[model samples]
Target: MPEHASGASSKLIVESVSKWFRTPRATVHALDSISMQVAAGEVVCLVGPSGCGKSTLLDIIAGLTKPDSGHVLADGHLVTGPGRQRLVVFQEPSLFPWLDVFGNVMFGLKLCPELTNDGRREIAHRFLGLVGLEKFERVHVHELSGGMKQRVALARALAADPQVLLMDEPFGALDAMTREHLYDDVQRIWRDAGKTIVFVTHNMREAVCLGDRVLLMSQAPGKIIQAFDIPLPRPRSIYDVELVGYAARIADALRGTVGGGVPE
Candidate 1:
C-alpha cells in the first residue's frame, strides 16, 4: 500500500472542462463546459452516445489527456498528469504479455523503489484475491479469458490502493454473461475496498448497477443532461432491478442522453 495523507481531501472535481480534437481535416468539439464533482467514496457512472465524449471526459478526469480549457481536480487539487493515486482501469487487460500475472501486477511497484519486495508481494496478492484471481497469480496473461484478463487489469489497479479509480467501460468487451459476473465481482470488490470510482459506459443497467449516481451526457459537446441518485441501496444486484418504476426512470435517462438532449 502507498502513503495516504491524513485529513487530505479525496474528492474529484471538474470545472468548465472543454476539449477539442484537431484531426487532419477538421477540428471536432468533444466536450464543452463539462463540470462535475464526485466526493470521496462515491461511485459515479458516466453514460452517453458513441460521439458524446464520454471516454474523452474520463481521460481528462484521469489526467491521461489534458483539456484545452477548464480544470480537473482530485482531493481538491488540480490533476495534471497520471499518478499512482488515481489508476485507470481500461476496457481490456493491458498487461505486458512477457510478464506472468504476478510480474504484470507487480510492475508498477517495481518502479516505486520506496516499497520493499515483501510489501509489493503482499499488496499484489491481496488485490488478486479481492478479484477472485488468487489462484491465477502465476498464470500467464495469454492463458486467461477476456473476463479474467480484465479482472487482472482491475486487480492491478486495485493493488495500488488508489484514492480514485478511473474505469473506462471495464466490461464493455465481455460477453453478456461474463460481463454480469464481472459486474457482481466489481461491485463486491469496490464496496469491500471502499474506493471512489468513476465508471464510464453506454450500458444503462451497468451504470445503475455500479453507480450511486448516474450522469447522462449529451451529443458531441457533452454536458450533463440528467443525473439520478440511485434510490436503491447497495448490495444492489442485477436481479434487484425488477422494481416497476426503476427501469423506466433509467430507460428514460438513457434515451434522453442518446436521443440528442430531447425530452421524451
Candidate 2:
C-alpha cells in the first residue's frame, strides 16, 4: 500500500455522482450513484467494460463536465470547474503540431500565469527530462513515434504541476512493446512526483500494474462493483506471476460484471 492509501487525507472526493445523456431518440443513464475517493498521492484506476461511464466520472472529477445529482470536492473545496490544481491527459497525445516537444510542454505551463518565462521553461525542461524526453526536446510531433508522443503528453500534464492527475486511457493506442515501456516510465514518474492520479483503463493487467487500488465498474449506468487493493511491491512488471494472478482474479470479477469476456 502507498503511504497515503490509509485515507489520512482525501485529495479528491466523489459524492454520489450520477450522469445522464439525453437525446431526442433516447435517454441514457451513464452513471448511477457513483462514489469514490482518492487519497493524496495515491493512484486509483477505474476499470470497466465499454461505455461504463469511466471517462464520464473522470471528467466530472476534473470539473470538465457537470454531474446531474452529485458533486466532487478537491482539497475540501467543491469543484465547480476546471482548475489548475487538476489536469487531464486524454487518450490521444493531442500535442500541438506546430510546436516542438519542449514547446508543447511549455504550453501546459501557460495555466500557471504566475511563473516567469524562465521559470516555465525550467519546469518544461525538468518534466521532459522526467519523461526521458530531454534529448528530444527539439523534436517535432510528427517526427516522433506513438510512445514518444504519449510521453510528451505526460510531460505536458506534469509540467502544469497539478495536485491531481486524471488520465483517460492515455496509453490505450500504443503497441504492446511501447505500452510496456511506458508502464515502467509512468510508475517511476508517479513514485517520484507523488501526484494523486485517477486512471481509467480497460486492461486488467495495466490497472494492476499501476494502481494502488483498482475500482471495477459494472456495465452501462456504471457503478463501482468491487475494489481490489494491490499490495504487490513496485515497480511491478506486467509479466510478473503474482501480478498476473491478481489480474486474473480481477478479470473474473470484471467478466461477471459485464456478463462476457474481458481483455487482458
Candidate 3:
C-alpha cells in the first residue's frame, strides 16, 4: 500500500445527514442524522440488516440521492450532484450487452469529455489490464461470466479515475467461490490505486476482510451504532482465525442492533 492508503487525511465527510421517503400509505425515514468521515485512500465498510439504509446512504454519497436534511462534503466542497470524481458500482454489473468489453469501458469515458478518442482508448486498455481483463477486451458482455462482468464494470469505473469509489454490494450476487476470489482482487486493486472506498455489505466476514473500519448500523431510520477498527495486518483472509474473531465481534454487535438492543 502507498502512503496515501494509510495516511490520516479526511476525504469524504457526511454531516448530520438525514433522509426520508414519503409514500401514499406511509413515510419511511431512511436515515437519521448520520455522520462520519472517510480518510483518503482508506477502505470503510458499512454493515447492517436489510432495512438499515446502507445502500441509501451510498446513493446519497454518490450524489444520486439528496438527503432530507444536512449535507455531504468531498474534500471540503459541498456535494450537490454527481460528478466523475465520485462514481458508484452497484451489485449488478449493468453492463451494455451491445458493446464489447473495450467499448463498454470506453463508454464510461463519456463522463470525461476532456479526453480525446485516442486517450480514452488508451485509458480503457490500462484499466482493463489493471483488472486482469486485457485479453478479454473484445469479449461481449453476454459471453462473460458473472465475475467477469463485474471485473468489466470495475474497469469501467476505474477508467474514469474517480477519487472516491462507492460500492453497494458489488459482489453480492456471485457464487461463494467467485466472491472469495474477488475479495482478494478488490483488496489488491484498492491498495495499488490508493482511492477512498466506501463499501456496503450485509456480510460481516466480508466487511472484516476488506475494511480498515467496519461501521455497524441500526435498523431502519438507520444510524451508525458502532465503528470497529480492524487491527489485523493487510491482505486479510476470510478464513484467518484473527479475522474471524473480529467478524464474530461485529456479528454480535449487529445482532444487538437487529434485536432492538443498543449496540456495543
Candidate 4:
C-alpha cells in the first residue's frame, strides 16, 4: 500500500482476511491474514506465482467461499454472501450455451424482475457497445470469438450494475493481441463507468497497465509484499508502451515474488 491513499480508492475493504480448506488427506491453509483495500473506481491488480491462492482469495471476496476468519466490507456494509452489488467476470465467459448474447447478458435480471424489459435491454446495450459487442446481441455463445465472449461477460457484469466488479484473469486465455485489445477496452469502460474493479492475473504488464495500485502476493498463505502506484498517464498506447516504465518497474517486483519470471 503505497502513499496514493489520497482517497480516490473505491470503497472496497478486506480486513484481516484468511481462509483454509478441509481435505481428506489433510487441511490446507489457502490464505493467511491477507488484508488490503480498493479505493473507489480504482483498479487494484493482484499478481503472484502459481499456487499462490490468488483465485482462492478472489473466491472468498466474491462470497463463493467463506474465509476461516476475517471480514470483507463493501461500501461500508458487511458482505455475508454474493450480493447484487458485486459482479464477477471469470477467465471463461461463464455464459450459458443455451442463452444468446442478449439473454446471457440479461441473466442476472432474473433476480431483479422489478426492472422492465426495456430498462434491462437499455442497460445491456450500453455495456455491450462499450465492449464492442453491440452487433452480437442476438448471437449465441458458440458463435462468438474468444475476445467477443469475454466482452459479453464484461457486458453482463456491467448490466448487473454492481458497485464493485471482480475479474479473474478475464483475458488470460486469449492471444496477446486480443488480450491487449480487451485491456484497452476495459480501461476505457472502467474509467468512464466509475466502477471499482479488482482484477487478478499472472500477466505483470496487464496488471501494471490497468491497475491504479498493483498488489504482489507471496506463495500459499499469501500476503502482499509490494504495492506500486502506476504514475503513468491514461491511454498508454501499444507503440508508446516502451516509453512508459510501468511494465519494467512492476516486472522487477513481480519477479521477486514469482522467484524467477513468467516470461512474456
Best by TM-score: 2
Tens-place lDDT per residue, model 2, 1-264, is 321243448998888999999999999999999878889888999999999999999999999999999998899999999998999999998899999999999999999999999999999999999999999999999999999999999999998999999999999998999999999998999989999999999999999999999998999899988899998999999999999999999999988766778987
Candidate with the larger lDDT of 3 and 4: 3
2 or 3, greater by TM-score: 2
Please give, for residues 135-186, the per-residue lDDT of candidate 1 as tens digits: 9988999999999999888888888778899999888888989988888887
Model 4: weakest 10-residue lDDT segment is 1-10
What is the Cα-based TM-score of model 4? 0.93
For model 4 the local lDDT of residue 200 reads 93
lDDT of each: 0.80, 0.92, 0.89, 0.81
Higher-scoring candidate on TM-score, 1 or 4:
4
Clashes (N, CA, C under 3 Å) per candidate: 0, 0, 0, 4
Better structure of 2 and 3 per lDDT? 2
TM-scores, one per candidate: 0.90, 0.97, 0.94, 0.93
Candidate 4's residue-wise lDDT over 176-209, tens digit each? 9998899899889887898888899987778877
Report the lDDT of model 4 for residue 262. 68
